[model samples]
Target: MAKFPKNFLWGGATSANQIEGTFLEQGKGWSTADIDKFIPKEQRKSGPADNLVKRADVEFAMHDKKGIYPKRNGIDFYHHYKEDIALLAEAGFKMFRISISWPRIFPNGDDKEPNEEGLRFYDKVFDECRKKKIEPLVTLSHFEMPLNLVLKQNGWLSRKTVDDFVHYADVVFNRYKNKVRYWITFNEINVLEMSGFTSGGILADNIANRKEARYQAAHHQFVASALAVKKCHEIIPNASIGAMIARFESYPKTCNPKDALANVRANQNNLFFSDVQIRGYYPSYIKRFFKDNDIHLKINDGDKKILREGTADFLAFSYYSSMVAISPDATEGEKLTSGNLKLSFQNPYLRSNDWGWQFDPIGLRIALNELYDRYQVPLFVVENGLGAKDKLSKDNRIHDDYRIDYLKQHIEQIGEAYQDGVEIMGYLIWGCIDLVSASSCEMSKRYGIVYVDLDDYGKGTLKRKKKDSYYWYKKVVESNGLIL
Candidate 1:
């Protein structure tokens, strides 16, 4: 058995939008997540497209009164933190990664003062973690940006949002300076390109030039992230802030030079966010991308200095599967898998989950090496897990050996990566407790060691049950990856 370092963090990852319900409770305003309607599996598509009709449908659904808004009542985590944290402590969690909802604190994104009730809520949550000897890995913004920002300021597309985000960061950094040492500026900042509205609150469908709007919004987010890093360091002593990206490792479809070149460009395009956040500057390759796409980024004078000075302390990312990129002339009709907010060509060598996400534990090892070699910084696997449909047996036990096997394989790969000289900080499985799915917005796409008794239509007992993998994971954590 490969042994991890003594201080390696073992826990799970969840975001406020996915898990923390009470969207309109305790002075919290509506977030973009609050307005995101549940799209049926058949209605989903490969990539983002400009559709004003769909955007209007979403807006209409927001006020339809009978529309099913799943996020509005996320696993009811607002009322179950103590119970959930106790379960996590039982699993021997050394650290727990969760996001602080922007709207929860600010109500509106441009607020002069934060809501006291929202502040007190996290105060109790963080204090509970302290009681259980669990360190909280906090993300400043997770997809739950206040909808007010999007409506009033056009989301991150406008430079004014940079100051609003900084104000929110300043408040939280000062308040939780002592509780949280591990901070992430943004969750999957790279998703701003594909899912601009959900990730950064830029409504791609509403913009005339979708590419220009998305890239401009991404630049604003980059500056905001850098400013947050600077503020986090200034306010919180001994804080280590990182940038989180959705990592989609790509491989050439074949040995053809065109395929290889296409793969390289795809990887570079996906890696653009980390390049700026970690390397402290934009890559030169983006110049070609900008010119070819007719995209012009609006940059201010001191923005460069801010980005240079606020390089992230480390790099954290979520890796679910690897993708295969082919040349434009390559044949179609290949099997497809969903991941990282994009549809990718399925790898014939890998298995897949019910959600059509490819299973590739070895890809994790490959990703760790590539990221480490590129930046030479400590890497944290903050989100990695299988989303499956589990059945409650007659004996009231979830015999989810499949889930255990999935995690076991991934952890073993992490061990291999560690032996290969990667500086891995931790492995936090996605959704320690069952919560709403971020992409599908369905509770049925379950991924958790501790299962929550919630149905897809938001009707269940809300009971917490431990699956077989829960005990298995507890043992793995207690042994620090040796038991697996």
Candidate 2:
């Protein structure tokens, strides 16, 4: 096997809310996830509604609670950062992709002054990563917004949220400007529209009207992202700031041109966030889509200038599986929803993960090739992994050959993309440790190479057990490629 670039990043990915679970500890107040206690259902208000059992679920059920579901303490990454980082280091990670909790930093979304305790927590976290000589790629916002800001100011639907986001980003950039080099302004910024308020951590009632609210909220975020990019350069002139999008591999449902056209349109819209961020402007197709739909955005003075000047240095995205989108007239069948997309199981031919994200390793190569052709910027795959249900035998060993198979095939495609002149930056698999799933907020959808014993009901000791994939991944990373 050939070696990857001398400095290529090989790491696992995680988010503050999903892994670091001191939701209200230290100076941290209730974030948007904490405010979810009143949402009444799962999937929240964004792409999919998710009722992640609040603290009340751990004791007395709330009015909108769905029985006694798992409590919000996910995998205890907040308390276990050192142990987990050691595991990641053992896997030979050159870099570690992680995000900071907004509420942890700001406590309140609109706060100009950051909480010293909140900032200090990350000080330790990043310092630990740097101690291990692992580069830290930090995300400013990852689906977590302070609830007070959302309820009081009406969330991202208002332009005020954009300014608040800039302030929030500034707080972290100034503190960790020297420690972290790679910064992603938003995580899956486009999903705020596809899944509606659910993806952005905003409540459904806050949306008021789903369609209009989605477009309006996304408009605010796009501008906010542009401003973040611009401010990042001002603060850390040499920082590599990129926009993170959930890049889906779109496939046509049929050989017919009609199906092909529909598939292309879907990809264009689904992947259009990058067009705006990378190109620093909306694409022609996006303008046409808005005109045809009569969806107008609230663009103010200098917003275009911010986007144009704040274009990202590169593109970092998450790819788990491809979706087969059919045209309106084509013969419709089941949809693939098993792997990471977790939409609906509409495609019948493909197999999927327990959570319904379709499994397609070939899609990774296609996604890489396509992004290179269109954007012509360096690409970094920040998140890609298989989430499954792993069982522990009496001997306490987990035989997770399924996960090894999934990663092996994807690594093969990564090799193909690298050899094909894709200028691939790095590959960070999702949930290096067994953390909560961002979609359903469940532990059953396991993605970690190292397994955690906790379940959806929150039973068992939060033990970290190395699965079979752990040893396999260590070798893969040590070799800089798959050993096969």
Backbone clashes, each candidate: 0, 32
Worst 10 residues of 2 by lDDT: 51-60
- Candidate 1 C-alpha lDDT tens digits along 315-346: 99998888999998884777667775678887
Q: Rate residue 95 of model 1 by lDDT.
A: 93
Residue-level lDDT tens digits of model 2 in 1-484: 4457766788989988778877478888666554323222363453433422223332242234564323246677878999999888888899899888888877778777888998888999999999988999998888778766755765787788888888888778888888988999888877776655445544465333455667777878888888888888889988999988888777777798987998889788778888888998877887787777677777888888888988888899998877776777655554334434336435666676665567788888889999999899999999999888888878889888989899888888888888888888999989988887776667877889988888776676888989989999899889888474
Clash pairs for candidate 1: none
The deviation in Å at residue 479 for candidate 1 is 0.5
TM-score for candidate 2, residues paired by index: 0.91
Model 2 stretches with alpha carbons more than 4 Å out: 1-3, 35-71, 201-209, 331-349, 482-484
Runs with alpha carbons beyond 4 Å of true place in candidate 1 = 42-58
Best by TM-score: 1
RMSD of candidate 2 to the truth, in angstroms, is 3.6
| Decoy 1 TM-score against native | 0.97
